[model samples]
Target: MTSAAAVASPATVRPSRGLAVFWIVAGLFGVATSFLLYLEYVGQLTGADPIVSCSFSPIVTCGPNLLSPGGNLLGFSNSIIGVVLFWGPVYAGVSSLAAPGGMRRWYWRVYSLFIAGAFLFVHFLAYRSVFEYGSLCPWCMTVWLATIPLFWFTVSWTLREGVWGTGAGTRRVGAAVYSWALLLTVLDYAVIAIAAQLRLDVIGSLF
Candidate 1:
């Protein structure tokens, strides 16, 4: 029978510095973008002008989305959620860098779950913004931009590290997917871009 120490020290892949750096950059970008949106929301509450820096036109602005019912779907500004949760990636990256021995499988599993939820939520917001509001929110788009990669990379890394499974086949599949994480992220961006263009004529509005 395997000893307790052996069972606890199962061989597994560790997160690399590159992945850590990506998380840090993406997290910071998300935090900054969300904070800007939150400040805009605060401005609106103070009876300030609706037309803010990110507002370019009626079809391509954040003002309506910010004031709309969907903006406060959870009884407060969605940007506040973004500002608060974006730090998770930053903290994970810092921890990985500080302790290169790597985190436990359970920790990564929970983190991946959090990122998955964020991925779905951002896309849902995107759909509502395009179909319901018929507007393109620049700050919200930035949040989506940051989240897309964060989701893909975190999933990929967790897979490669055996957080999902430790079997040889599982790790192989994880390695394959990890190598394509960037392409997957780009494809995701393309899907959102296509949807936005079809519904809102985003390109035409910009020109």
Candidate 2:
């Protein structure tokens, strides 16, 4: 007998119902954020001031932040790209849940890559917003926050299922690195927010 017949391919694993729901929620958030950005863009083009539908807060104004040079990083609106990329994962996630055979391994692999790319893109934008732009867009920040957990959960799930690599040690190291980076990013944001608050308080006291 040929050695080729000695072994069977491993069975494919499907994501749990919980994971399916997580993906759906993440996709929806991405869609909502993109829509808000589009609205801001329309307001800008029409020379109309962007209106905040939410409660009045410094963090809620999309206009001042969007019109800044850093917002249009690629010389055009980032929302256009966000709309296109956000829907792909949404469709794939919903289809994965409904399909009897579940999503193929390659499909998950591709989806992970796409989401990772998006996570990185958003990370860059957030960094620019904090350091260079010095202004925040509430919708964009919401999307950014949503993306952090979305990417982390997806990558963790994929890694656990052995979709990313065959070596367990390599996967562990990668996961550790990702976790540390996420923690550091969160801490950085916290520090920035605290410092900003302190500075504002001090200025108010002096006036």
Best by lDDT: 1
- Tell me the tens digit of each residue's lDDT in model 1 across 118-164: 99999998999989899988889999999998888788767666788
The candidate maximizing TM-score is: 1
lDDT of 2 by residue, 76-159 (tens): 778777776777667766875677466556777888888888788877876666565555566787777767766766766666
Error of 2 at 119 (Å): 1.2
Clashing pairs in 2: none
Off by over 4 Å in 2: 1-11, 49-60, 170-207
The estimated TM-scores of all candidates read 0.90, 0.74
Candidate 1 lDDT trough over 10 residues, lowest sum: 1-10
lDDT of 1 at 176: 76
